[model samples]
Target: MTMASIAAPARTAAGELATFCGSLRWAELDEAVRQRTRELLLDLLGVTLGGSRVESSSAPRELAQGAGDGQATLIGTRQTSSADWAALANGTAAHALELDDVTTESSLHPGVAIIPAALGLAEELDASPAAMLEAIVAGYEVTMRVGNALNPASAYARGFHPTGVAGAFGAAMAAGRLLDLDDERLTHALGIAGTLASGSLEYLSNGAWTKRLNAGWAAHAGIVAARLAGAGFTGPSTVFEGRLGALHAYTDEPYVERLVEDLGRPLQVMRVSIKPYACCRYNHGLIDCMLSLRGSFGLDDVERIRLGVLSGGALLVADPIEQKRAPANVVDAQFSAPYASAVALVYGSGSLESYSTEKLADPRVRRLMSVTDCYRDASLDAVYPRQWPAAAEVVLRDGRRLSTRVEYALGEPENPVPLDALMSKFISLAGRDDAEALADRILHVDADPSVRALGTALRSGGGST
Candidate 1:
């Protein structure tokens, strides 16, 4: 079939989005948005370096190592591979630590999927830093917009991971822009991406590694889609609003208008939240509540711990009470509200070390987890996907009830994590003595003539497991 035959009617959603992605320029971006993009890039790269040596990241890294040499860099290692393979390896590593940046309304990790693809492709094309940054912004716009329309709660219920699904579109846009595809080709890239989108929630059942792979695969598929489109491949233009489109296929109830609502007035990158704790974004507010009550009572003084949770996130963090209470491994613990709360109370912190195997087996943590109960709170859900508020009550052994609520968790846009704190996080993850210097380079990356030097620097710095 001809490209025109498969194209949607005039001014289709995909067409409009493609026009925006194609026309976006670095000079048109607000300074704040540009800075935020830089910060996010720094955050994602740090996380990738930290997670590069993880057991879950090993397979993809090995695969990339043997995928044949090219210009793209495999983050945290002195290796080069094809752009798609490098994106897969780096994306997997970014998500492995569960510390990647996440969006509020969309409820997905955008940086994990978009940054890797943008960075890899930019390096391969020898694209300027400004071009790459513009691509990154375009990618975030498409990913978050599609995610918003999916109604994250509904998508999660259907056992679909929004990041993997929406991320494919975002990656394609970023890659297509970097590849200098025209508006028509960019539309086809999105259409092709719609068919490639996929990510299942089955990993929740056994703490499997597929969760990390979702982000990797999304990035890989995006580059492939863009490349195919640039090579004159055609895809349906009604990829978003059609009867059999992504909205209908992946979600029970999708807010279709959200796909193009308020097109980039403020930019989606500003809405992204950097993760303070190394776990599910759903559990961050709960952890905040737990930490706030930590100094108030001794572990033994607590009779029962009741947590107010968002109904939408209940399945990922609260449901299957037994499993949540007794997380089998790091992956399970990362998604369990009970485990996150208990660990925060016992350890007085919820850092990556808090989720280690040793901490998972701690009798004190286990005892505390048994007493913690997560219940859906309408009050908390009212402003969800926008605020993510949480509440917790401690019923003491002496019948005293102490309660507290968190309107905004640290690292959120409203309650932003300080630059010093963000830098500390980056240093800890980058695991190199020159991490601060590297971060400086990343922040000013837009001035660089090309991303090739950045890749060389990343390889030289390396990263810790």
Candidate 2:
């Protein structure tokens, strides 16, 4: 058969990896790709540490305690659960704070959802850490390309969180790799993961904790699917392109071609944005611009703040409750543009501490937010969903005006966050001891045979917190 015929069979065959899993060499990846992966892993660790402290994390820790027997670590929660449950617990904790890294195309918290799931299962299997990283890299590529084919707006506009719905499959891909599932087994794992995919954007309207749970759901589902595949279960191979399949039901329709089109050639997670603030990724540029002016203008001198952005940016943070407008719940605060922008100008950036009710409702913070106005700017909206930024104007009581605009946020591939800053951020969130060691270990993750040794030590036998 010619090359084209071989490609055709590869696309249509049952155990073909649409069965053959390519062992992508780390050395083959460009230095930039490796560098980006390290940065993302670092940011993910920080977010997971902080998120592990959230109240949402408490439920899982409680359950793990009740189970009374298991051998898996719950991230920074200092608890233990069965391997699968540990994945669920850590995954939930990692995303509970909503500070996890997000990719533009994956349209999901790729790091929080996929990493914990992949790593959690890998630890249980005592799989080679390098193989685990390769799986993660492959999984990231699949999800983002699949998201591209998904035409996310179809479900997103209808109040469903598309990322969670699709992220399960990505996590499964990673699990399949670590489990060493051959073509048929990998196919079964992917298909089995389909039934486990769930979550809706309705939580945004209710301020529910489901938003955080969605990430954990993906991690859990992937682990379960992998377990079943290992147990000799089978599943349909054409999960995505089937007549009444995941694509037909959830998205406009999956562009099947994108699934393996450029699989090993490029890495999608490398392009992920490491958010500076806990608020929505859409609002970061405006927050960035505001923080820039706050330095020169001073918070006390500012009488009013105005944030202008593209339509998509505005939609993300516009809310119903006046409290949501000014926010009290940390979850709610992350969705409030006016509250976030004002806080950044008055303060600096929104971290776990910034979104507490006390901070959100502080009289001075409210005063600044009350004067804040969010508007749609035609120029910014023109290139949206691709390249869009924010412009902020600060009007001072002293009759002075200062304005700043950004075309891109700081942590994008183009304008990356420096390693020094990433390390400090990690130390702040995870404590210096844990952060420094994990940073060195994971940056070279592709080389290690097993991360279990490291994971066991970090299991935080603080025992039930």
Global lDDT scores for all candidate models: 0.91, 0.69
Q: Which candidate is the best by lDDT?
A: 1
Error of 2 at 16 (Å): 7.9
Clashes of 2: 4
Task: Report the CA-based lDDT of candidate 2 relative to the real structure.
Answer: 0.69
Q: Clashing pairs in model 2?
A: 16-19, 129-449, 161-201, 323-327
lDDT of 2 by residue, 1-465 (tens): 332222222354223443434455456677887677667766776777777777888887576557655656677756556666776777787787667777654456677667877777777778776666677776676556656556555556555565677777778778878877666666777777778877687777656788878877887788788678767766556677778667777776456665656655556866677766676777778777877776786667888777776664444575443554566566777887787787786668766567777787788788887777777788876766566578888899998888889988877666667788777777777754556777676676665657676576466423346
Q: For candidate 1, lDDT tens digit of each residue in 21-136?
A: 78889888789898899999999999999989788898998899899988888988888899999999999999999999998899999988899999999999999999999999
* Alpha-carbon deviation at 75 in model 1, angstroms: 0.8
**RMSD (Å) of each candidate, 1 decimal:** 1.3, 4.2
Q: Candidate 1 has what TM-score? A: 0.98
Evaluated at residue 464, the lDDT of candidate 1 is 38
Best by TM-score: 1
